[model samples]
Target: MADPLPGDVIDRVEYDVERGKVREFTRATFTTDPVHTDLPAAREAGFDDVPATLTHTVVAGHQRDQRGFVDALGLALERVVVGSVTWTYLRPLIAGDHVIGTRRVVGDERREGKRGGTMRVVTLETEYVAADGEPVVRLEEVLIERGEQR
Candidate 1:
């Protein structure tokens, strides 16, 4: 089977309202849009609350899954290559919301490179909502960490 990188990992993160970290991410990442910073701007955008910058992902144990992908192939992390990074948000992420822990695979063909080179790409999807879980926001994050070819 595709047991190249055969380990399991879980990442846990929490987000809330009235924090400067969001604003800091916006500024550091060069996301100058007011919606990402100014609550007033977000309101104009039809958002009931401030929006989360695209980069503000809950990437905690992300690397752990990548490590598993490699182990399943019987190859080490030094054998692959990072290809791309992507994330999609189903709804606007506002403050004072918490997202639960979710699991995702390396996508189709996580370990397809064994000869020329490999792109160890993994896309993670997440959702943030009120305590009731109405699906307020959905996000898909892509992480690529290359490995070595033997």
Candidate 2:
């Protein structure tokens, strides 16, 4: 496969935030916030429904795209590692919200490794938008792929 170019779209998926999923994610993450699992608590917190943890997007995206963007780009999964992840939350996601996430390639570069090989760094950005076209969260992730040793 050819190297992914900037602006290449990896995938787009729609995720439905269900109450059960929200509660499950909260418990799995060891979150003690009742607002994420209880409708009454969430209503008291000013949310229309149970609010999902900030990191719920990770699970939602992963669940929809199990192969991941790197794998979609045809990169060797064994040589790839997540270098960093940054999230910009524009709005809180709650149960009953329908979100559409689009993953795209934003940047790509290669550098010489200290160990005498090449290191490819890829930057991907995924924007999660609500059904009403409002932005919910923006996730920027950097993946590093190590080249073969000389």
Candidate 3:
């Protein structure tokens, strides 16, 4: 029963703010928006209580579950492939906030691609909330279970 798929609940995710994580994310992502990478600029821009970039918050929400999901399926990081990723930002995320992410299996379907094999696309819908329980953002990730498309 388990080999076909994991459970409906992915895992609970939490992110504690780290200045290094925020800074490194800003630098590496190549996002030049001052409000996203500069604290002083963000303050001047009227976001005195929050960090510059919300993208880091999004990353935090995601990275929290990568490890657990791998284990759930008895999968090896080396064997699985991240076929695609697309995120729609509903609200701006701020720094210095604790974020919680919860994922659930929203969809599961099998299909055949160009190779005419079976591929399973499992949709994981995640909701990231601020510590106050305010919805910060929502994310939907479609993981293509490659090689399984037979």
Q: Largest lDDT belongs to which candidate?
A: 2
User: Model 3: residues >4 Å from true position, as ranges?
Assistant: 3-7, 50-54, 61-67, 73-79, 148-150
The better-scoring model by lDDT among 1 and 3 is 3
Steric clashes per prediction: 28, 0, 6
Model 1 C-alpha lDDT per residue in residues 1-150, reported as the tens digit of each score: 543222233343444544476787787789878887787888898877777777666433442465654455444455434454455566666755565544444353445556656555655455445566766555555555555434
Deviation of model 3 at 16, angstroms:
2.3
Q: Write the per-residue lDDT of candidate 2 for residues 25-113, one digit (tens) a residue.
A: 88899999899988898999899999888888887555565576557777788898899999999989989999998888999899998
Clashing pairs in 2: none
Over 4 Å off, model 1: 1-14, 58-75, 106-130, 136-150
- Per-prediction TM-score to the true structure, in the order listed: 0.60, 0.91, 0.77
Q: Model 1 lDDT vs. the true structure? A: 0.56
RMSD of each: 4.9, 1.7, 3.3
Cα lDDT tens digits for candidate 3, 36-114: 6677887897875336354565565456656767676444455355565555556666667677887777766767867
What count of clashes does model 1 give? Answer: 28
The count of backbone overlaps in candidate 2 is: 0
